[model samples]
Target: MSEFQTKVSPDSETFARNRKDMLALVERMRALEARAAAKSEERRPVFDKRGQLSPRERVSALLDPGLPFLELYNMASYLVDDPDPDTSIPGASIILGIGYVEGVRAMVFADDAGINAGAMTQKSVDKALGAIAIAERQKLPFIHLVESAGADLMRYTVELWAHGGGMFAGLARLSAAGIPVITVLHGASTAGGAYQPGLSDYVIGVRGNGMAMLAGAALVQAATGEAAQDADLGGAEMHAATTGLVEYLAANDAHGIEIAREVVSGLGWKACGPALPVCAEPLLPPDQIAGVVPVDYRTPCDMREVAARIADGSDLREFKPDFGPATLCLQARIMGQPVGLIGNNGPLDPDGAAKATHFLQAMDQAGTPVVFLNNTTGYMVGTASERAGMIKHGAKMIQAVTNLRVPKITLYTGASFGAGNYGMCGYAFGADFLFTWPNAMTGVMGGAQAALTMEQVARRTAERKGVEADEARLAAQRAKITAHFDRQSDAFYTSGRVLDMGMIDPRDTRAVLGFCLHTCQEARARQLNPNSFGVARI
Candidate 1:
């Protein structure tokens, strides 16, 4: 293995500018995350008055102490509810992530009942489905902190109603796969929401607060002219004693979470496999990554520099280095876990595409996981490049990525444009896990190019119709299109919309990669006892 040498000049003007821009982007992300937290905090008084813990508080208390919790899609529905961005809080009235419960790594999600009475939204439903997909794929145990008023009818749509069934289907799938599904009802879980806990293998409900019913007392009386109390309808005590819906009844939120932890502890999950090879930290300081990647996506930087900063001991064995320099393929170890890495120094030419395809296949043959450090304007275009078979080669690369059996992880270090996104295993390619840098941008192409293309189309249409082209109108239209695309392509916008999980600081790249790699490895090694149907309550 050849040691990668760093050529980045930290004191250079360009590096300083890059560092400043990257830090500012990171700051913006932090502020947005803080805003979401603050919004949830605003309901603290209400939760306290009800003798319950906040959604975040419940999550914290449920997880093991000193364990790393990777929260996914923390900003799911930002700016979706209204026009004003400030008024829209992102989290989709839910909190979801992977964390340790009783030493067992599991997928845990909680209803943010503190927000909008834990009403379900389109994005929240998507986020929940995404979380469930991860848990199902990784064979991780599923845990839910159920507290929801169900779907909000005011803003509900037929699409949301139709897609809502997937949530229940996912729960059943997880249980059928022999992965335990645990639920703790901390508050209301009415109507369709009742199935969330009902489908779980184990359920714990808070005595005074927990409720799960198809219809509340008011609805029962309104429909049948029979007055009934909530306690008789779906209260925790009723479910635990008579309905056989809840397995355990707790006095409060803390007790419910405690019981959940205990249930996970009793699962008898196997321990993780043997550790990877011992390796030293990267010789290059990971902190330098902030300066290494320019904020401007157009500015070129060596992807190898990023490889060096993340690889253990800065050792990366280049594979066919001279054949295709732009698309770098290398073998390196992150935290002693060997991995094949594909990165970009420029657009994917025919040669680069072929090289990457070969590299992906070789890695799969070797049973090594691959990590994509994405940064490209996509495949090289134009008459010369197209003549060189760019489309054929790019398709081959995409095919290799799509068919690979190995776990694929993607990190958008910079611009991920055009089919380069697919070739590099973007979200559509079903990466085992995907994350982006605070400065990353993902779209079909840059905003400027898209605007110009639309402008040309409009001008050509006017000419074909024998009408004089309106130059001023075309210019104004182009400006609007450009601005919209630019805003939509921003990292904040993409991340908020759950484009690729969530954004991370450049400095934390190695640690995050190492954590995810280990997770994938453990999942691949573990075995499960599947049944024809999921375990059900009597």
Candidate 2:
């Protein structure tokens, strides 16, 4: 065939028809090209400032270098203002994808802050749901780097009724699956949107950036007659120290992402069990020594510091630290075995109790063994606790412990008084082992206070004798138990009863924990059927 064909001129009518078709095709091509250009330009805005990295950049930093990120629903975009505005961003408000972190696959959703203040659109919700569905099917753990203005308002007005407002249902379903969902709160995550991270298993937050709560100060003031700043409303400190919502607090973005990656690396691919350690430390530190148990029980020690000293270095992950100031709960590895560390701080407020209950339930479900470091004054007292219903919520902790199938060990460090003693797995609380330090005091109430109970008899005797009450007798009575507890022999003998009753080993203070943790790790490994190099026994 010739390079150029011989032209056969068409009839006038036919030429006109052919021209019209060509023009229509050209117009459609131009429209398609315009759409393509717009889609190409719809990527995240340029990164500015040392503090702020784009959502994709943050996600990329978390995952392994150059890992394939297969984005879900990349073409999704919202219809703002007009029925279908010509200029609309693509990839939805959040970018959902499957990527690898440390060579292990993970389902990820990074909120695009550059897109409409990072507000979640109906399309974004669908994308998130779709990504979660993929994770569920593949059993991949989900990680969300959330930083958004919550539900997109412009697209959610009455005229745009088709645009769904919230993402509660989809996120709830993802959480219900019980797979490890790690949320890294990069920036402003407020209102209903923040709950997604709040409900997650592990929420890693930047010190000044990560915030998860019901409403911001502006909304609160608008709705109620209250004035509060963003920080006062739901800042990192509030969630960490007050609400106990944040699981891990990071120093900065780098630190936050590093911690998040560590969390994921720890989980591996398994959702049902914990990973074993490579090497076991013989004895952790001062926290487990039992020597310091009697040292000023009233002193407020950072439970995080205590847990760190006991567990393997950098292996302690505390949960709900803010909520339950009176009690401490941590998930950590001791000598390579996963164990839940529960302790008492003095007394936590009502909010603290609720947070503790939630942690207890989670720890139980994870099938991890628990170690209780008991040192509590009592349950919180006051109208706040009563109104919050500490009694009802605190019951969940007891119920969870009673129903727990895993091994539990309790060590009374100091004054395990009143309900606090019972809260931390008392003698009858079904703990596999219970131990008390030499100088520890576990009773219904403090010694000096209990001695004053016989006031009527003292008053009558004093009245008859026409003299002041005998304060010396009260001191003597209080000293009686103190003398008994002070005897090293008596302390060991009493501990022996605990040992005899299968509560704990009477000796080997710090070493016992290491041994117990090692045993637990071995047991879990066997249960999980880890890869073995040996033959079966006869």
Candidate 3:
């Protein structure tokens, strides 16, 4: 009886427009992901000559067949790598995501070695480190397909070199924490990259192709005048036989992948909890999500309409629905996971913030995970709102979100501007996982509002000086401010900067939520085997 009544109107022109814009954005997101794959594919010939499989092919081979591979940060370093829309190859020269490996879900990080020799950039390094953090926190095994040319010296910054050390540190930490860290060296992993396989619990190196050593023959000859072939110095066979570095040495790339899968399979890892309730798909079709949200978030639509398609059986039990009507707190089961979802039908007033604060604590106490659907234009501003203890109650909601021990997952379905972003568990608050729809935008405020505020300040300055505001100059300035905000607030651009995990297609929201929710809960239930140190070379 408490289930939300769907009020979606698919037949309306607004729905048609929303559907069209949303689909275009989703297509754009996919096209960019394809671009990264294409860039890697172009290097197939080079990899073929070396008798090595491409980065993505290695991932495909490593993961179990036909299961979901939830790719993370596909648009990573998108425009940041190369600003041009035609040429920016994102994903930091890596194909990284979470997928099932030999029936065990693991975090897979593969150097898209075909691109820039799978060179590590600032973004790429950060991405890998982020995945490792997830693995250690979520209890997922970490698998790395190593074949990196190391850091790009041409673009080197001291900060990047220093930050890149975290990748090796993360692997070491994973091993020490008893979360398996597996490295399959498909090709060269020299210099700083050598430690990647070295720190892992299990290292599988390919006999002819794989190489892992602190120094290569060129570097060794340059420093110490010791000239030797690559294999004799640091080849997989050498490491396996002489140094005790590699646990398994395979004949080639495919064989190396097989070894990695077998290593995971041998872990005998399983989910520690009882089976979840059966998931009956929502009554409202998922594709309808495209039509539910207007791309220009200023256009208002019921958040419940979107919720209907995401919650199972299209049921969302509204909590305190009468008070703080603009803020929605709903109890729902997403793929059998009990969740408290908070969404904004409008800006958060004092009442709304207070209500959300109470709801967050309830969910926390109940041990239920929370999902923040970011869409507010921040807490309400102006004289009336200020008098209502806006800041006090807003801070309480944020505190509750920050202190929550239960898993926090955030999704930016539309506009999330100002303090609303923070109050609703934005990135800085450390939501366990954060994702966005292609249409989502978040910032201090919307472009129009920002530009208008500046214009008002300019006009006020002129009025005080007893001079008329220059209409043309004022108009030009407003346009400039709006354009700057619009460009930076774009989902693709933000996702490129690693602002969110990735830009997801709106239709896949439900499935992605289920997977993430399950992952978080499983991690909480599973026990870890702690040790004194990471697997050492000695």
Candidate 4:
């Protein structure tokens, strides 16, 4: 302790001065970065769309407060002859980084349409690939805002294998990693850009700004002589209504960003539980939820209100509110348990199979218990339906539900007919339990439709047998067929192969649901942690 004790501590003034100097150095570096940013801005082209927010700006609005964006490939770009000297603007067309959305860590990448029409350069591809690799390695959600003019033809001329793009390879690798990938289309997303989002788990589009496909109008016209407008070529309506490429159709850019936030929050993040409350509310008045009787099968009812009532506290975060309007899927808490609810839109247009498949797949991965609220007249029909590839699209839902491992509870709020029953997670469709309220008039088809069919059958039989078919008897037969699987009996759990091995106790809906949630919670052992990380996107 001789020499050490002899050494005196530095004076407070000297220490303070050194600390100030270090801070000053940091400020100086920040000023230099700002100056570089300003110089880059000076070189940006004054294009037709100046008011539109940049990708970085959009990301700023979308992410959580106080979180920093670790920009990937910040200095990677064209070496020379680039008209736009704003290096920060394009960042090689793809901006990949890790950031926090709502305090949840996630990987975010965006195709900057403002730069080279968001073309995919080799540098950009590498940046994207690297970002996704990081995301997968870290088990973070990957968000992509794609809006590109496809790959840079300039980068491809030298190599014939350029056609065998490495971009697809990167996407395949990212998909195989099983990281929840979410995409938002804010502008034209065609060819390679379109393919990037195509492989993601969740894809959303803005009504006017979003688009996706192998070819746009100009290319289609050049190749097939098909002149088309933007909407006809690749718009939100085109994808949502026909191709089913977009899972959600946003009302506008703001709507799109909000939807993106929701999607990110709902991603399969095991670090934090859902924010929705699970306490079940008191049963709604009988008048509010009209009983699902035989007559109710043909009648269209607003399933949304029904969903709100069923979800505890009536707070449900409905996904894809606009697109795939026919099928209503929501994330909510029932009796304090995370529940994924899928319902049938009584009158809204079925957005087609692509959306159905997407919804089912998303729900399956969410790892939340599922609730099916059936109310549909089966799949859409006619040329419009065929054009949207309904058969192929809807089949995706069937396959997903079959493959899903979560406990599914079906509540026949109204009609459950034909494929609609299956789509709504019918008893045979792997639902753990199917329950109907006292008003439920369960059947293979609507009694009215059955009545009409019986009328036709009666006429056919009368003509052949030369005898008057008993209309009353025929009516009874129609009722029997309507209630074939589930007779219009009370809500008792029956046995011996009738309607879901017999219906669960109807009056016990509240109790049954609460018990099921408790059982599920116990099975999982997910206790509330005071040190909960809360909802995070990454």
Candidate 5:
């Protein structure tokens, strides 16, 4: 394998300009993430008065000291909650991430009760389910710091109740699949929320604070005219002694977290993977990635240049290069771990699609993780491409990606448009950990193309109606359409809507991918012990 030569010059004016633009986007992303934490901080007095730790504090206390925590969807429900993207509260009232606890890796979900009393929102449900999927795929333990206000009745939607059941169902499935699920009730877990800890392998209820009940006092009185205190109905003490639901009762929030940590430690869990070879630092610096990748995605740049900075020793063994010049399949090592990488040079034609399909199958056969550096206008469209079996070849690539036996990680680094998004492991395609760069754009098509397409359609319709096409009106319409597409395609906007995990600076790509691939490899190597059902009360 030959070392890739650097094409970008940090001293060049273009590189400087791109780096400046990229840093601005990174700053904007940081501010949005900070805003979520700041919003929760505003309710610190409420949490302090109640003698409770915030959701974040619980997660920190549960995880091992000073370990990296990969937070997911920090901007969830940002614009969805309010029209203003800047001032909106994200995280959907829940904190979700993967972190090491008691020296064992696990997924943690904590309800941000400091925000809206931790009411379960639509995106909040989606975020929790997403975390569960990652845990199941990665074969990691699941830990939940529970404190939710059930569902938001005022902002009611039928879909919220419908989709929210998946979280509890996921907990049951994880336990049945031999994955540990530890849930700690730090405060209220009312109505349907009770099933959360009920399905877990281990349940810890914090005394004087934790509450899990099928019906609260008001609900019980309204339904059957029975008068009973909520504490008597389903407090930690009641459940611990009467129902046998609380496996461990804690003195407080901090105590509950300590108990959860002990349970994880007692599981006798450890991760094992193939011994990695000594890794070499790439000749390129990670800081140079901002300069190497064009801030303006429309400006053509070789994705191989970006790969060079991340690949160990800047060496990528190119596979079937001449066959599909536009679609690249490169075998390389990142942070001492081997990976089969797919990067797009342009729109995917039949040959490119076929080549990518073959590459994916080969990687899966070898049990190597696949990383898609998506930067495509999409699958090629036209009579020439159609005649070459574009649809059939492209379908093969999609099928291969969909059925990949190996871990699939996607980075929306650049332009990811149309069916190309689907073919390259888009959000819906189950990429174990899909992410994006701040400069990335994803949609059915680019803004200019989409606007031109609609304008053409309008002009044709006008001509068919025996009316002269109004140029001024069409121009205005095209501009409007372009703005609409551009707004939605932005990485920040789509990320806030819970598109990818969240945006990252281009410079951090190597570190992020290395961490994710390491986790995936651990899952593949570790074995689980299963039973007929999850650990249940006997």
Candidate 6:
């Protein structure tokens, strides 16, 4: 294995510019995340008065100390409600991720009840379903810190109503698949939300704060003229004693989390096998990664520089270095886990696509997990490329990426555009965990190129109609389209729309990839007994 030599210069003008741009993007991400946190913090006083923990505080207390919590989809609904970037916060009113609970790794979902009473919006439902899908696929136990006001009626959509059933179905599937579902009702869980705790294998209810009912008092009265108090209907005490909906009752939020942790500790679920081999740290400082990627994606840089900072010992075994110089394929290790790396130095040419196709098949044959570094404009165009069978070769590469059985992780390091996004295992391709750098952009094509394309179309249409083209109007339209695309292509915009799992700092790339790789590896090794139907309360 040869080490990838460094080509990035810290003092170079490009590096300096990239560092400044990267830092700015990072700040934007941090600001958005802080806004979401601040929104929750605003309710801290109310929670303290009620002797209850905030949603985030509850999550922190639920996980084991000194363990990493990989929060996912933190920007799920960003900029969706309003056009103003300053006011739109995008976490879908839920904090979800993977973390250690009593030494066992589990999927944790906590409703940000402090924000809008933890109302379930369309984005929140999508985020929940994504978490459920991950839990099911990874064979991880699902732990939900329930405290939702159910779906928002004001923003309701028929699509959300149709997809809401998947949440419950996913829960049942997880249980039947032998993955435990545990829930702690931290506060109100009314209407459809009540089923969350009901479907769980283990339920812990906080004595004074917990509430779960198919219909609240007002709703019950409206429907059947039956008078019922909140506590008598579905409070913690009632559920534990009368309905048997809750297996455990705790005095408060901390006690409830502790009880939930204890249940996980008692599950008898042991680690799959021995610890992984010791891995050497990368020779290059990971911090330098900020300068490795050009701030302007059009600028050319070696993708290997990224691999150097993230690969264990900065060692990489290049595959087919000459056959497809643009598409780089290599065998590398991250935290002692063997993985295949696929990255782009330029657009996917016919040869590059062919090389990638072959490389993916080989990696799959070797049963190695693959990581894709997406930084491509797309497949090369022009008559020469078409004559070179670009379409056929690109399709072959996409097919290989689509069919590979190994765990695939994708990182949007730079430009991800055109069919190149698809060929590089974009979100639609279902990368096990797709993460993007703060400076990343994802769209069909560059804003300028798309705008110019439309302008050409408009001009051609006018010419065909024997009318003079309105150059001023065309220019304005092009500018508008370019601005729109530029805004939409931003990492924050894509992240808010749940495009990638979340936007991560460039320096944290290795750690994030290693954590996900370990998770995927564990899931592949863990065995579970499946039943036709999930266990139901008797």
| Top-scoring candidate (lDDT) | 6
Candidate 1 per-residue C-alpha lDDT over 333-429 given as tens digits, one digit per residue, 9 for 90 to 100: 9988999999999999999999999999999999999999999999999998899999999999999999999999999999999899999999899
Instruction: Put down candidate 2 lDDT per residue, 190-275, tens digits, no spaces.
Output: 87677777657788877777777688887888999798888777777678777777778888777888898899888745323355
CA lDDT, every model vs. true structure: 0.90, 0.60, 0.88, 0.59, 0.88, 0.91
> How many residue pairs clash in all the candidates, one count each?
0, 5, 0, 8, 0, 0
**Model 5 stretches with alpha carbons more than 4 Å out:** 274-277
Tell me which of candidates 2 and 3 scores higher on TM-score.
Answer: 3
For 25-120, candidate 4 gives per-residue lDDT tens digits of: 334334533543454344245322533456656677678877455444443343321434343332566556667776656778877665667776
Choose 2 or 3, whichever is better by lDDT: 3
Q: Is candidate 2 or candidate 6 better by TM-score?
A: 6
Candidate 2 weakest ten by summed lDDT: 1-10
Candidate 3 per-residue lDDT, tens place, 1-538, comes to 2566677778999889999999999998888888888878998888899888888888889988998899898889988858998888889988888999887878999988888988888888878878988898899999889999998877788978998989878888898998998889899998898878878889998988999888888889999999889999889999899999898989999999988888887998866655777887888988899999999888997888888788998888899999999999999889988899999999999999999999999999999999999888899999999999999999999899889999999999998888899999987888889999999988888888899999999999999999999999999999999999988888888888888888889899999999999889888888888889966777
Model 1 misplaced regions, further than 4 Å: 458-470
Name the weakest run of 10 consecutive residues (lDDT summed) in model 3: 1-10
The runs of at least 3 residues in candidate 3 whose Cα sits more than 4 Å from the true structure, single-residue gaps closed, are: none
TM-score, predicted candidate 5 vs. hidden true structure: 0.96
